[model samples]
Target: MISTRKKLLAASIAALLSQAGMNSLQAQEVIDEMVVTTVRMSEPLLVETDPRKPRQPLPAHDGADFLKTIPGFSVIRKGGADGDPVFRGMAGSRLSLQVDGESVLGGCGHRMDPPTAYIFPEAFESIQVIKGPQSVQHGPGNAAGVVKFERNRTRVTEPTVAIHTSALGASFGRHDEVLDASYKTPEFTVRAIGTNAAQNNYKDGDGTEVHSNYQRWSTQLSAAWTPTDTQFYEITAGRSDGEAAYADRGMDGSLFEREHYGFKGSIDNVSTLVSNIEFQYYYQYIDHVMDNYSLRTRPAGVTERAMNPDRETRGGKFAVTLQPFAGLTWVMGMDAQGNKHSDRSSMNMAMTDYRNLLRKRDAEFSQTGAFTEVSWDYNTTQTLSAGVRADRWSAKDHRSMVMLTHMMTLPNPTTGMKRDDTLTSAFVRLESQLGDMPGTVYVGVGHNERFPDYWELISKESAATTSAFNSTDPEKLTQLDAGYIYNRGNLRGSFSVFYNEIKDYILIDSAFRKPAAMMGMTRVATIARNVDARSWGAEADFTYGFADNWRAELTLASVRGENKTDNRTLAQLPPLEARLGVHYDNQTWSFGTLLRAIGSQDRVDIGRGNIAGQDFSATNSANVLSINAGWKPAARWMVTAGVDNALDKTYAEHISRAGTDVAGYTQIARVNEPGRTLWMKAQFTF
Candidate 1:
């Protein structure tokens, strides 16, 4: 249900903008413009989203939502908030994620709070995506590449005070506000930022209500000192809290609180051997609460259930850039992390107080890694690069999962012990300019090793004769990343393809169905097992400037994964998809529209997938259209508005699970996308 208060707020925002009358203003807009239409290919297969210039229609609510605009990226939406990002066919920890160069992890075992869930995209500077396992600089086990939300601090030229603020309102009682302010001088600086966003449940194309609703807020403070041109030290502290409702799951997130603290220092031209050196240390904490009563009504037969989970992570990194020769560059770094996951719950299944309950640590994980990358410039036409990294990981299970099958207490099957692994990754690539062709072609291959995360380790029902946690081994990923960038005249295009061969690929087989008679409650539990898998995929993003005031942007993505052990296709693999856009821009205004089409996925292994979600037959191919316009009559303020899914078509993503179950309905669990909605926003920079 749409909240009345939010509706009033939306009305106020609309009136405020309408009263401005920007359409007739003749003032020239001189503010820095952010582009929602397209992003230039910064590097081969690396895409950067301009946070200020967001695209129209369905604006991103979180980090994962924002990533969907890029090719080869998708989100498994369980609700309006905290969606998990999927790249190609990889999800979860397979994709390395960093915010402000800090690594953070979620505490929910069911993935109600993913890493991206903690990020408010509008408050960040930029988002970058590196497709495929082409490099090891970010982190280890990045078989699906890396995504980074960066906030860069610029050196103060003089004493300055800057502020940026924006507000948004939309249908379904959606409201968002953001503010960032910084004061700087040559010697020191301080910055403060905050964001608030909320939305109510939405209806599908059929006008059926969905359970997705959320309200979230975040704030951060930073202080830095710069005594010299080549040296600087900064400290950042932040805290965030939120609540969300999910239609796909039985429970909702009532409390999503997180805290972060980080310290960073950098020095340039330290010595001839060391060109640059930087160090970072960060501490992150996640305290999450999931229940059935806060955001949704409890069903008659269902007991009011609630869970409180916590995760603490501390990590640090030290890197050095070296220039031993004029044409050679080397970057070497080491990173380490220590993590602890625990939870407290009330067995009474009421609105129980978490503070009154005793906390139990379920698992502990730790990692240490070292990496070195080198690039050699033989000439202006050719260059060679290579990198290698190694990591040591360990995990310990402390949960007491004593078997109580059929009302009998049996010995714990999980063995509740520790496991350790040593993994290594490396890559090499060659690049050369295509002479006279106005394009660059590059090819590279890499090997990545990823240790099993918490889901695979402590979330399983142990066996009597064997331990599922111990049987699982580190996943070995060997892949090739290659593409070319072509820029000639007004047309610019880039295409990339990747192939991967995985050994000891961990596949989750959730085909096991335990009857209530045997387990006292019916449950569909996932079982982790090893499999041999091979995958290949390709995606391309292109832009062409044509006509007097027009430009076109196109994107295409596809992937195929197969399990050799079971001789079946990989589960949760999305089908081919395409997005095309056209835009018209004038000196003070701009407008655009986009067409999105999703292909039906026929190659799927039912009842198998990672922690993201399993594929269901309810998925259907669909086509959607949306359009938006913008007005920027003054440099201090600008306004943008758009409608997404104007056709109000009903469709479900292939990676989504079945919605709330309904008797006698086959697709009862298929969570449908939101229906036709309207929204508008105004941004300010001064």
Candidate 2:
């Protein structure tokens, strides 16, 4: 009975695939540095995005179109893949997503799958962003910040074996493929990654026919161990599945299974107030399936439905980093998380099975945390930082009623009850170096205390006997962030700003409307109270590389929200955007072009929205144009190409979602975005 967390995950994957081999070696120079990094030079509001160098003509199948080209990000299209990402004006679990560091929950309470939908960003290696709520180590409510996706640990000086492959094609019957492999000697190392992608049904810009199609696949495994040279260990496992089709729900995901496990360890030097030590443990699982005639075409008697939901989350963490002297540094940590959810269903077409139905668990949650941080280097251009955190949240509700149909029910309002909280967070930052011309600046302040999820505590409000998971209360946030970065010679740039204030804020009132004779239609339910809100934002980036092969770039973003408890205008924000680019290179080719512009948001209430959608009525403003080219021609090959949305514009993305007017359409339609395409990608390495 290998229990006990499966015997510590099989002794941490046997200490990360122990093999213990040691000898000086060198294999083709780490296989020519494993190529993949074509222009990455931006940082301020912390911009990373390096999914093995992919960014050109947006076909980013997931992770919200690869975080919408960075800069305050935006995405909420629901068609070809699970699009959903919005930052600055925050959304969902208040941002904070993780992948190499756990937290991967998604069993569709209407969100097909978030957590970057089981990520597949060119087999990950970079993807980081931490904007607001400054930093809190990595757990607990982060108040719109953090998005990690890492898989790195390759620093070999001998014995190496590496391989990377990529292929992609586009223009409506899109296709993609990827594989990554690694092996090393001198302690331990192993890596693996795989992916498959697909697409179909795309036509817009006056050609009609939306309703996107999709297919996906994934696999992963990683191992690391050093046993010496300062100690280190790691183990990872992964799995992924596919499904798609959704012009905005009435079911259509057809199943997407996933599972992952991780174990981490580290130690370096370790002495004098302790210097460097880290730990982690993780687990994630999800099995989803939603049906409306398996992907499309329904209605011939209708009575055919299906549902199979699942979710599980687990976590752990431990950290230490102290430098008793020299510029000072300290970090301490402890983290914990837990999650559970379950479901099963079948319908009138009589069971063709959801395993004959019998699985109901409805929510359970837990959280724990403690933290401390400090960094000081008051010399060399000044720097200072601070941090603090504390958390203890809990939840439980095992459903027993509240069905709302199938013969009307209503009681479960958090049946069996259980709710708890005790939160706290903090941050502080300051830095300077502006006077030296190389430019640099920083300022930060953050505080977060959010507690309320699982759709604002038990499916968006209503149902109290003191429970909808306990009458609200716990939102508070205060933010102020600032940034600036500039590089001299040949010019480069960055700028950032933010301001937020939210107290109690937990909005989403949809204005009731549930009884249509006990629900035959008329539906509209959103509930979740608490008000007072405010948001503000700004961003900018610029680049130029006069001659020597030329270059140009510019980006800007904006956000604004308000609803100081109902003065209106704070439901699904994100508008005013811009992007521009141009480039040229030498030594075997390179070229680029980009242009994007947007602005137009009416900000209404309409059925309300925020689990990633809602607010429409201001539409107009749109533009697009793209171009790319690259070629290495030798040295393990490389190729690139593009042509995206080049005027095939048919926009629609004000935080989408809505439109189950199926074939005859008209539920306000809207779910376009994806038309002019023409892609090409190829990569290889030995």
Candidate 3:
């Protein structure tokens, strides 16, 4: 009877396929648009935009800066650059970030260098964002969402040379330059890119200087060979280095160096059943150094200290897409990655040198995953999509001792321990077109089980154990997402909402204190613990073209989280925010203004948060206004200028890090945003 039922189901599917016309699968070409102010949602649960376009309030120097322009995104600012990105109040490993299909990890134990630090936004052609865990084609442990920085591949029919370059000058001694050059023929192509950005200390609205400054540079080279229109192979190499001063910590990053190498290839039209196959392999290394003397002056009676940490990662992926019949598609893939972390430090830089010491390996991690996704367009008005993925995660602890203070140390309880977990994730979604109103609505539910990352396991201790390596439990998340999009005559808009229930959620507590006898002193100790949590959020944006050359846009985002176990507000969550913009554009010039408002956040769980930092106190509401103008002087040549913080309002974001006392700077409650800044940019193409 089971076999007969299976046969009948197969017959019904075959009949449905017969009714739908069969055609060869082909790639769709997408044209990149220049987004000036705000990036609107192009579709339900997704956003695609060109990274090269110049936007108001100064162009982005890194990935986090660019992502903040979109709704439902915020940054945990540490200094002038290298801020961590937060989406929908979730941060750290929950948000999966990939650069050209490769995973990169930071080396800083305190998160001075996030994965987005090494990313130069203008070097990439496009940025794609997938909200919620609605798909599993990427790697595992993406309980929040996924962000991808991708480059476009173009087949050259004839010999060609193209160059796109830009330069910028801004207040506070800020300057930036970028160059992208490519040479292509029918058989092969070569491309090179370079970027430089630097800024000095900036003052707040009160004209008080903050200890924030940075300088960064990067270079990349790539070569691609194409044998046919549908087949291509590419190899890429890059390096980046920088230094930054922070106002939120005792130490500043003196060296942030990164090295990358990758290889990728793809083939299409392999057979009737298979449409395409793709593969990629990548290697990344990060070497970081932090000190109190390099970027700032040592305080009186304070010994000079420095630390060096590094991480090495190797990963690869292989995927294949198959079209078994008309209106049916399947994508299957496997990905694997491994990373090792090591560190060396000098308590007194003048007495002992860290460079001569051998680094000690602390933790190592590895993960292998397999995923399959299917999409079936059963009819013209409706479609169904679903995906399933399984991952095997393993971790090893190499620490032999744990330090409670500068002079106190004890044997590590979880030394030489190993843990493994096999987790599963899946999601299903259905979409339907609203009759003939040029609108679409969809709903989805996803379940993701996430293993603890290195920071969560090795950087902090468990509630009962000296080490969290073997005690931290994996996080399980079940989320429901729904959205609607409409595009008609003169107005376009989109709204997306999500609700999540997380079990065994890893929560960091900075207020935990160990017994004075155990620590040899009385002090707070950061620890990780599991708890139940729930969060819900919504993001909406609308744009209307009122005149031939005038348009207005409004965007709103808000999220609320609760610790169900403790019955308290979740820590480090961003408050409600809104942005309003008006723009006028014609063939020769364009002008725009942006108004941003942030609601006051009274709910707080002070001294508790994630690996980045804990919340300090409740935040007050604030508002800021900015304006920009652009002109086209000649063909392929353009110029733009803008003034940010026009009113010079002294304010700090709700998610900003607390300010620390520096030797030569005034200490505030939190790191303040830049005030009354002016910038100009020039771009040209050849």
Q: Which candidate do you rate higher for TM-score, 2 or 3?
A: 3
Would you estimate the TM-scores of all the predictions? Answer: 0.91, 0.33, 0.94
Please provide, for model 2 over 1-686, each residue's C-alpha lDDT reduced to its tens digit, 9 standing for 90 to 100: 55998978956733432211011222111111121212222544577767765566555567767777777778777777888788876877888888777777688776777778778877887888877887888887779788888876755767899988888888888888989988887688888888899888777666777677889889888889885777788888889888888887677887788888889988887887787898999887888988888777786767777878788888989889998888889888898989898777776546467776778988898889898888788798877888989999888888776554434556775687888888999889887885524567788889988788886766665522323467777787898988877654445567888888889878766555654544477665556777888888888776655455555668788998887867887887778888887666553577677888788777666655566566645666787777777777897887877777777888776766655656544443778787688887888878
Q: Judged by lDDT, which candidate is best?
A: 3
TM-score attained by model 2 = 0.33
lDDT of 1 by residue, 62-131 (tens): 7888887778878887877788899998998898998888888999877898899999888888888877
Higher-scoring candidate on TM-score, 1 or 3: 3
The prediction achieving the highest TM-score against the true structure is: 3
- What Cα-based lDDT does every candidate model obtain? 0.80, 0.74, 0.87
Q: What's the CA error at residue 66 for candidate 1, in Å? A: 0.5
Q: How accurate is candidate 3 locally (lDDT)?
A: 0.87
Clashing pairs in 1: 34-53, 35-53, 658-669, 659-669, 659-670
Better of 2 and 3 by lDDT: 3
Give per-residue CA lDDT, model 3, range 183-290, as digits (tens). Answer: 999899999999999999988888889888999999999999999998989999999999999999999999999999999999998899999999999999999999
By TM-score rank, best first, the candidates go 3, 1, 2
